[model samples]
Target: MKFLLPIFAALLLSLTTVNARAAEHGTAEEAIALINKTAAYLIDEGPERTFFEVSNPRGRFTYRDLYVVIYDLQGRIMAHGMTPRLVGLNAMEYRDDDDKQFVREMIERAAKGQTGPVDYKWVHPQTQRLHAKSAYFRQVGLYVITAGIYK
Candidate 1:
């Protein structure tokens, strides 16, 4: 009984810790760092393999609401961490309810231009509700890598 109590308590503590960290996982600074790191990883590993990883919902690149998405300079979706259906689509025409051309703005901000934050509204992967978001991205050689955090 003594050992059981200790074990159960340890397990509960670990679970609590994990969930708390996940709840606070994605942030602006983390997004920017992750985007740059993912860009380098994609370059080193090649797109065929990296894209598969990025598209996997449970993969390393998909952490809670924060996932890495890559778009080619021409506005085509290359890899999406959560929405596999978005792949190969020209997301340039996608707009928010307010007619804000977010993807287009992201391309402009991230494609051979500068590394900065882009604001938009998007559907939450878990909540299924729309939320205001800010994404930080960087342009690598062939693609622009992005990671976002919802507010």
Candidate 2:
């Protein structure tokens, strides 16, 4: 009957909405967990080993689309999870598509001895499309470590 068809369509729509919400992957809490994990690894293994692991694509520091980046107090990149060539680059002057001074804020937060949560638009390595990303940074000893979630 015509009434049954509408009811079926409405049920299908509701199910799709539920699936969409269930598929939500990354969150700020996930970024915090990543930062904490990197910090523990940094303390346990030191920068040399930790940096290597963080930059490793198959390493433990990588999960889903989240990756770690390490920097010094002066804002020079020490390690990057998605791009190893970025290592040794001073990216403090870099800006996002929206001209957001994300790296600068990361350094500022680290210098102040607090965690930084900077949001910007960046090209996702996997999709090669620009997406809204939120990166969190923490100062550990003489270095800073950051991880981000793509929203």
Please give the CA lDDT of all the candidate structures: 0.83, 0.85
lDDT tens digits, residue span 20-124, model 1: 856774888778777877887888999888888888878888766789888988889999988888899998888987799887888887655877687888887
Lowest lDDT block of 10, candidate 2: 18-27
User: After superposition on all CA atoms, what RMSD does each candidate show versus the true structure?
Assistant: 5.3, 4.2
Query: Candidate 1: misplaced stretches above 4 Å?
Result: 1-22
Error of 1 at 148 (Å): 0.7
Which residue pairs clash within candidate 2? none
Clashes of each: 0, 0
lDDT of 1 at 84: 88
Q: Candidate 2 lDDT, tens digit per residue, 50-146?
A: 8888888778887777888999877888889889889999988889988888888898977887686788999988768898888888999988899
